[model samples]
Each structure stands twice: as C-alpha cells, then as structure tokens.
Target: MRIARTVGMVMAGGMAMALAACASVVGSTESEVQIRTNPDNAHCDLSGYEGFAASVETPAAISIPNVAAPVTVTCRAPGFRPTSYTLNASADGWIWGNSALFLASGGGVAILGALVDESRAAGKSYAEEVHYQLSPDRPRPVRARSRDGGTDLNLQAR
Candidate 1:
C-alpha cells in the first residue's frame, strides 16, 4: 500500500513538472519596445511579420511579438532624410533556465517544455529601446567668386 502511494505521488510530481514551461511561465511571447528619434513626431512604420504592421509617431512605445525573425523600422519626416533600422531578435536568457529544469524534472519533461517554447518563440526578444537620427534633406548653398569678379551661387548637397 505504501509503495502504491509513493508511485502515485511520483506520477503527480512528474505531471506537474511537465506543465512547467520555463519560457512561457517566466517570460513572455511579446515585449514592449520604446522608439525615439532625434527630432520627435516622425512617422515610423514597423514590419517583418506577415499581416503584422504598425505605424506610430516617434517618441512612442510599441508592443511587438517575439519571433525568431527580424523586424524593420522605417521613419520619415518632412525636410529630413528618411531612415530605416532592422530590429533583430535575441534569445531570451530565461530560455536557458530550461537546462536547469532538466535536473528537477528529468530529461523528458524538460525537453518537452523546451520544444514548446521553441515552437512558440517564447525565448526571443528585441531591444528594449531603439533610437534613430535623421539628416536634413536640403543642403547649404555656397557663394563662389567667378572669373569675371561676379558672385556665383553653388548648390551642394551635404
């Protein structure tokens, strides 16, 4: 009878461990990132995931899903040259905790949990904050002395 009770307790413990997904439980499938520009209020567009697109003004916060891919951010403002940035995902540190879970739950349950996290991309994240700097579209004009002693206007793009 005591042996049977011990077996039941062990089975219950295993079941509980199987349900503990390190990344899903401790981390998130999405994270919020702050976007800022040298001059505020630039129109920014974010894309990468299919059917997922967002637009916002600079100096804002955006919540993006965690994926094993890159997200592109493009910004534009009047009189300023447009700029684009690629946001890459890095592995979340919490995902590594699954290795520790192996010791507690044995290899099988821990591996299962890790696979679930991998499928859901629960262990990837983008940078917490991103900043962009845009240059002016118009260039300054320079005055040069011509051969006839007349002033000439030289338009240069710098």
Candidate 2:
C-alpha cells in the first residue's frame, strides 16, 4: 500500500509538470506583427510594458513581446497628421485550455499547472496585423478625368 501511494504521487507530479510546461514548450512569449499605413514610408514608434520600445517604417513586420498591457503606436509622416493607436492584449487560448484540463483532471497538480501557465508570458497575445489611416495635413489634390479616360492630378491648391 505504501509503495502504491508513492508511485501515484510521482505520476501525479510528472503529469503536472508536463501540463504546466505546455505553454512554454509549444507557445511563445513574443510574436511578429505587421504594421502598415495607407501611405507607405511613415515612421512609427511603439511603446508599452516591459519598457518595450521600437521604431519602424510603415509596411514592415516586427517581433514584439507579448504582455497583458496596452501598447501605444504612434505614426508620423511628412504631410500627414500624427496618429496613434493602442494595441490591446488578449488572453492566450492556452490559459483557458489549461484551466479546463485542470478542472477535468480533478487534481491539485492540475491547478498548479493552470496557475503556472497563466503567470507566464504565454498567457497573452497581440494582434497579428495593425493598420493606420493618416489624414493629410494639407488639402488633398483634386483628381480630374482626362480625355483618354485616365485620371489627372489637379495640383491646384484647394
């Protein structure tokens, strides 16, 4: 009876560790996000949790850390008004799955696993793509239909 109890404890511990390691093993703490703007070549600044800060040109892909904190992205262009957007974090699916598994298993070890997963960096994720539409500071150039059915830019300032 004593040996059976010890074996059971060991198995439970191992299972807990495996489950707890799911996020760290199969998930990532950082993900790549594509940043884009209506007019390309705009400069952008990203700032938020963990002192995360980076600058990139528009139409670029960058790897960013994942945290359950709001990230602000500010973009600027030569003739456009500066624009900023907030990137909100969402809880990772693994957290829910881990918790569900723990509840299904009906063990304290599973509870620990769920907690471990939630407390780690794999608990949250950011959007895969972010886009911004910048309005021009000056009046937009007017477009006129040309004789050949093509469009012509009427540079006359509005």
Candidate 3:
C-alpha cells in the first residue's frame, strides 16, 4: 500500500508538470504587429501637399498575447489624414491574423534619420558627395567625400 501511494503521487506530479509545459508553449506564441506604408517607394521631395507618408501598427503602443478583443490602429501623414477603424477577431487561445496600414511618409522619416547619421559621421554636407572608389585589386570603392567643406575619410571594405 505504501509503494502504491508513492507511485500515485509521482504520477500526479508528472501530469502537473506536463500540463504546465503545454500551457507555456501555448502562451509563447506572440501577437504580431504589421506595418504598411503608402507610395511603396522612396521619394526625394516631400514638400508638396500631394505627397503622403505615415506609420501604422506600432508595436510599442499595444500588448502581445492579447486575451481581449482585437485592436485598431490609426495614423496620419502629410497628404493623408488621421482615420479610425476597428479590428475584429475571436478571443481564442492564440490571436492571429492582424494587419495595419499607414502612409509611406513615416518610413521615409526613419530612412532620413539614418542618412543624417551617415552624413554626420562621414563629414559630408550632402549624401550625394559620399561616393565609392574602386581599384584593380578591390572592385569596390571604399571611400567617401564631402560635397560641402568637411574632412574626408577612407572607408575599408570588410
């Protein structure tokens, strides 16, 4: 009788552990955040009112593994304005199939930020001044120049 009771306790513990592992695996699946931009390509000049840009489905503002109902995302850009909408999905153990849309301008801003940093580090006033030089041994030019007045530096290829 003692041996049987011990075996029963062990089996119950094992079952509990298995259930916990399954719960963890089910919870590990994360909710997805999708970002879509308009224009589909980069544009140099964004001064006109016709030009549109924006960001949608920002992951920072929302929560993952959402137990509640679906969430809505709304944003605006220069040409495009703010609009509100709702997303509907069943409250299942896993929340899947989510989407959002935005004007293309937000991504352009991000690209512009990176370009600005590159220009600053390369000592170039404009991005165009930075160019590549090639040699016989090295097919690619690894140096950049300053269009305006600034120090020039040589970049080495990896």
Best by TM-score: 1
Clashing pairs in 1: none
Superposed by TM-score, candidate 1 places the C-alpha of residue 158 at a distance from the truth, in angstroms, of 8.5
The CA root-mean-square deviation of candidate 3, after full C-alpha superposition on the true structure, stands at 23.4
> Candidate 3 residues 1-158, lDDT tens each?
99999999898656443333232334332234343334222111111112322333322222223322233435343344344443332333321111000122233333433343233221111111111112123334477777785868677753
Candidate maximizing lDDT = 1
Task: Give lDDT tens digits, candidate 1, residues 1-158.
Answer: 99999999899777657555778877898889999998899999989764568899989999888862578889999989888988887888988877877776677777888888887778788889988998888887766768888777576755
- The lDDT ranking, best first, is 1, 2, 3
Model 2 C-alpha lDDT per residue in residues 13-109, reported as the tens digit of each score:
7776777646655777777889999789999999988798999998999888876357899999998899899987677776665666567577565
Quote each prediction's TM-score: 0.76, 0.75, 0.32
Residue 72 accuracy (lDDT) in model 2 = 92
- Report residue 139 deviation for candidate 2 (angstroms): 6.6
Q: Which 10 residues in a row give candidate 1 its minimum summed lDDT?
A: 12-21
Whichever of 1 and 2 has more lDDT, that candidate is 1
1 or 2, greater by TM-score: 1
lDDT of each: 0.82, 0.78, 0.32
Better of 1 and 3 by TM-score: 1
